[model samples]
Target: MIRLSQDNAKSLLAIHGWSGALLGLLLYAVILTGVIAVFADEIGGWSSPLQHEPATALPKGLGAKLAELSTQVDEQYHDDLFFFPQAGGRIRTFFHKDIVVDGQPSAEGVEFDLDPNTLAVLDRREGISETIQQRNTAGALSAFLVDLHVRLHVPNPWGLLLTGALGLAMMVAAVSGLIVHRHLLRELFTIRCRRQDLLAKRDAHVIAGTWNLPFAFILAFTGSFFSFASTVGIPVVAMVAFGGDQERLIETLVGVSPAEDKTPKPLADLDAMLADAHARVGVEPSFVSIAHYGRADARVNVFTPPSEGHVSSNNLVYDGATGAFMHQKPGLGLVPSAGGVLFDLMGPLHFGNFAGVLSKAIWFALGFAACYVTLTGMLLWATRRAESQAWQRLARATIWVGYGLPLSLAASPIGFFIGRSLGIVELHDSMAIAFLSAAALAGALALSLRDLESLRRVLLAATGAVLLSLPLLRLATGGPGWASAFASGLQAVFSLDLAMLVGGALCVFAARRPNARLAAAARSGIEDNQSQPA
Candidate 1:
């Protein structure tokens, strides 16, 4: 256990509580969304399952299809090409070139979504990357959730910076929590049911917070790295190392700046390269990116998922002009290095996907516990100052967000289904409207209801009802039923449907069986600060 001076311990306690209370709501939002995003791939598949699952991510004739599509677009687009399986077994192919847009280098591209089985084009979009992204329909819901977690729906660099700072704050809070709770190991399993309501709540918070401190630190550190790497780290590195030439910096890092050979060359067969990569790596390729496509110096990079019993994956580089295997490398560099190993570890450490579904589920559970600890800690802090009107108002706000955000999240998918059914092109806006409307309704209920218990029940019931209807909504929106989905190898859709039903049932059950002490605490103003227009 850590030993600190009395004054230092007190200071650390203040730091921990304030750090969490100041941005607790926003931090909760990020953590909750991130928990869901751990299943982003499953969510995408569940939202938009194909009629027939593909045997492989890239079909047999992918190379030929890519060639045909390449001929249709302008030559400038041949500078960079990317292919990956997107939502609903659709293979997305993007052909783009870097160009100056508003004094910044941006990708202008034509993107195609192709049916994986037939290799037939399903959708076509042409624009700068950002605008094209806004038009994507297949992965709309998952993208929306991810964007919320990463940026809080704020715009680029500013959003990243804000989230990065939040990450640092979380780290500080976690460290301070460890310091303040001197008996951290003992508290990890300590809970006194007979204690005062406030004491019990505090003990519960400490228990969860103590158990979650290390995980929280890891998440915060890695999350901050991701947010800052592109937004700040890369810019600073480029300024110092490449004299602000981002392109040169990228080339150096990727280890692929072969002398330009722009002469028209028929690109080597990608299928052959993919087959070779699979044979060598013993895993399916997850993504393929081509640089200088159709040129003599073109290079293809095939990124594979981690092989069984592996913690990290490898990338297979090939000569795009000759279809010859070049070399296998770690993600960060052409050769393995300390930096590359560390860089490669960040993704799996943050995402917890290295072990697939089991790891993701464990991460989700831990993340949910972290959210609970944060919300409860904030509520306890606000209730301690209940004599102040501002504190009471904060209590109401806490109730509105803590119970309401889940309901709002559950409602957003309703909008996704509604917009899809109505053939609306941009479902993101529809989702935003639904989310905001639910939050408004939640706020209204929080204000009108005289007790926290009533407000909590109403929101929980609403969330349950919405979640229970989501499967039906999926069916109504042209998604396959569970039986058909199961028969057709769409286990993601079937499993998600069952998971939603189970989640909805649990929410309803919890709402019906409110905790006795918590209910009494709500009645005594410990939960809602007397609930009088606050």
Candidate 2:
């Protein structure tokens, strides 16, 4: 146990309580959304399942397709090329060159979506990168959820800054909680449900919080690093080390070619190079980026997921002009330096994707527990001061958000299905409308209810009902049925459908469970500290 004097402990407790009380709701929203976003790829596949899973992200004959498309686009776009898999195993290929947009360098390109198996062009778009990104519809559901977690849907820099501050506040609370909770080990198993109702609730909060402290710290630190790296860290470094030349700073850090060579050359076959990379790395490539395509100084980088027993993947670089292997390099630098090692470790550590599905499941469970602890802790604090009208209002708001948020999230898929069926161009707007509509309903219910028990039961039931209907809605909107999906080798769709059904059932069960203690506490009218049990 961490030993502290009485005064020190009191101060630490104050810090912990206030920090959580101030940012608890927003932090809970982030953690809960992140838990779902961990399965973003699976969600994308489930929402937009293909006829069959592809054998590889980059299939044979892709080079011919690229060459044919290259002849059609503007010559300036020949400067750079990128390819990656998108929702439902569709491959997205883009050819672009840098152009100034509002004093910033941006790509103007033609992007094509192809069927991984047939190599048939599924869609084509041409515009500035930003506009193209805004118009792309693949993985719309997963993208919306991820954006909510990453930025709360606010504009960049400001949203990133707000989330970064929240991360720091979470870190402070986690550390101070450790210091204040003197019996951490004992508290791990403690649940004093036989005592007073308030004590039991408080003990539940403490136990979960203690078990979750380490994970909370890990998430906070990594989350803050990601949020600030682009918005603040890179710019600061550019100012100090590169004289504010962000482009040059990136080139140096990423080990780009130092010499300039603009002479045109016949581009090597990318399909052959991809095969070579898979043979060397023992895994399928995830992304391929080419710079200065068709030029003597051209370079190609193939990025793969981590190999077995490895914490991070080594990116394979090749001479784009010759298709000859250059070197296998870590993510950040040419050689594995201290900074590179740390930077490479961050992705898997934060994402918990190092061990695949099992690790992701564990992270999701821990994240859910963290959300529970936050909500329960805030409720307990407000309940203790229930004599004050202001504190009572705070309690009502807590219940509205804690129970209401899930209902709103479950409602978003409904809008997604509806919009897709009608071929709506702006599905995100549809989702936002559905989510807010649910929230408004929940708020009205919260205001009308006299007690927390009623509000919880209603919201939980509503969420369960919405989740239960989602699969049916998906089916009605042209999504594959279970049998068809299974026959087509689309197990992701089947698994997600089953998971949603199970989740809905569990929520319904919880809503219907008898809560004797809450009923007893309500009957006693014990809303203040004066009603402590002997």
TM values, all candidates: 0.95, 0.95
- Count of clashing residue pairs in every prediction: 0, 0
**Model 1 pairs whose backbones collide:** none
For model 2 the TM-score comes to 0.95
- What is the per-residue lDDT of model 2 for residues 1-534, given as tens digits with 9 covering 90 to 100? 889998888788788888878888898888888888898888888888788888777899988888888888987998899999988888989999989887656889999989899999888888998777665676688888888899999977788988888899999989998878888889899999787777887788888889899999999999999999999999999999989998888887786573879998867988899999999978889899988877898899999988888888769999988999988987886788888888988888888898989999999899999899888877776777667788778778888999899999899888888988888865788889898999999999999998888898889999999989999998999999998998888878989999999999988998998666655544443443676521
Clashing pairs in 2: none
Report the C-alpha lDDT of model 1 over 186-233, residue by residue, as the tens digit. 988988789666667778888998888888998999999999999899
lDDT of 2 at 525: 32
Model 1 residue runs over 4 Å out of place are: 240-248, 522-534
